[model samples]
Target: MHLFSENLAVEIATYYRNVALGHSVVPKVFTLVNGSGSQYLFFIDDLQMERADEDQFLAYIVQEHDAVSYSRGTLVIVEKNQQYIEFAVVDEDDSEAIVCSAELTRDMDDKPIGLSEFEKILVKRESIVFGHLYDPVKLSEEKIEDFESLWEEMKPKILHRTMGV
Candidate 1:
């Protein structure tokens, strides 16, 4: 996993849009799971999480998204089709965000994705260049149990909205 570039992110969104063309509904939120490993990304809408730190962190977000605001959040992009889950935690300060943390579940016999040494090197480089970090760690079963909890909570709401029920 490596940090997501703006172009790459747009490509991903385009990929999904193409996939949904005349086949599936275009989901308002984006959730892409890296089947080869526990790496995935999802979009957050109407977020309600409490701010644990400074109130101004996400203060710049506006109805219309811009390039500068786009870089405000963390970005992680995984290479094609590997058993990995990738997560990017958005923060006001890129350094303050955990550039490389949160490991995806690995398949048996699959080489681990995020190595501390490798991550250290990447993090160091990214820190210097203001590049994003995309390191995926291995997690205990219990730790990642709630990874899809957001989707679970939203499923019903999405269904209702989509179905007009």
Candidate 2:
């Protein structure tokens, strides 16, 4: 998370900032996929409870990401609807944050990756990145292994506990 983003600053401020106290806001959705083409969705809507715990978990995960991350930063998980996950980086002192998204996407040929399609033209895309190791969103062998192990650790704690196997 060294090159972390500040893209979600506006959203955090508009929805989560408190003038007197610190600020906290759920940015958007984030998604995950199990090996067998099943999906798990996670997010914090207006109704969800234990916001602090969820946010803490997200920050921990991002910090513990097998890849090299920052020394003193965390990815606050705000929401997750599908494979596309949105994380918020918030600044309580300044009400600023960066948006990080992990999505299941397709190539130019237009075919779905990981998750099986529900219909003919639905969520179809194969290449997904939990952590963009470098620009252009390509991952190496070590990074892939890191992702797998991380997924294993995260399986049970995830919000939507669904297994496709």
Candidate 3:
């Protein structure tokens, strides 16, 4: 997973808050997603709606993150979800702290209300997608084998890119 340092997350949150307040876009929640599927969520103290734009906002995020090398993998944006309050693990010990106010529901049990309902719910939510790169690490033989099997099914296109393929 592409993990971000705590300092990095705080810096991003501060930047968005400053920009949003200055531009009168008062954003409620901020989120960042790295190419590796790691996510960061930030809750806004006071939110407004005028400053949300995918490209400009992402540009700011990339610049702040010094993520130019992995520009394709870093995404930054804000979200406004009414029902749920999203947050991040600030202190490793306090993973329940409210960091942001929006999140992705990965549980099948909490599936979206319905197509039409989902659309209405998403109207206030904004997102940005980007790419990021991370260092490679070695895995155990069993893990490698498992990854290979999963990759074969989920990312067959990557096979040809592997060394000695």
Tell me the spans in candidate 3 whose CA falls farther than 4 Å from its real position: 1-5, 35-165
List the lowest-lDDT window of 10 residues for candidate 2: 117-126
Local accuracy of candidate 3 as per-residue lDDT tens digits, 36-122: 334434332222223333333333443433331121111123432323322232221221221333222213443333211111011
- Top model number, TM-score: 2
Which residue ranges in model 1 land beyond 4 Å of their true spot? 1-32, 37-42, 52-150, 156-165
Task: Report lDDT per candidate.
Answer: 0.29, 0.33, 0.31
| Alpha-carbon lDDT of model 1 | 0.29
TM for every model, in the order presented, reads: 0.23, 0.24, 0.23
What shift in Å separates residue 67 of candidate 2 from its native position after superposition? 23
Candidate 1, residues 1-165: lDDT per residue as tens digits? 323332324434443334333333222232221212222233343345544211121221211112121222222337433322222223223443222222222335443333111121123324422222222334455533443454456555432111010
Off by over 4 Å in 2: 1-28, 32-37, 43-137, 161-165
Clashes of each: 13, 17, 18
Candidate 2, residue 124: CA error in Å? Answer: 16
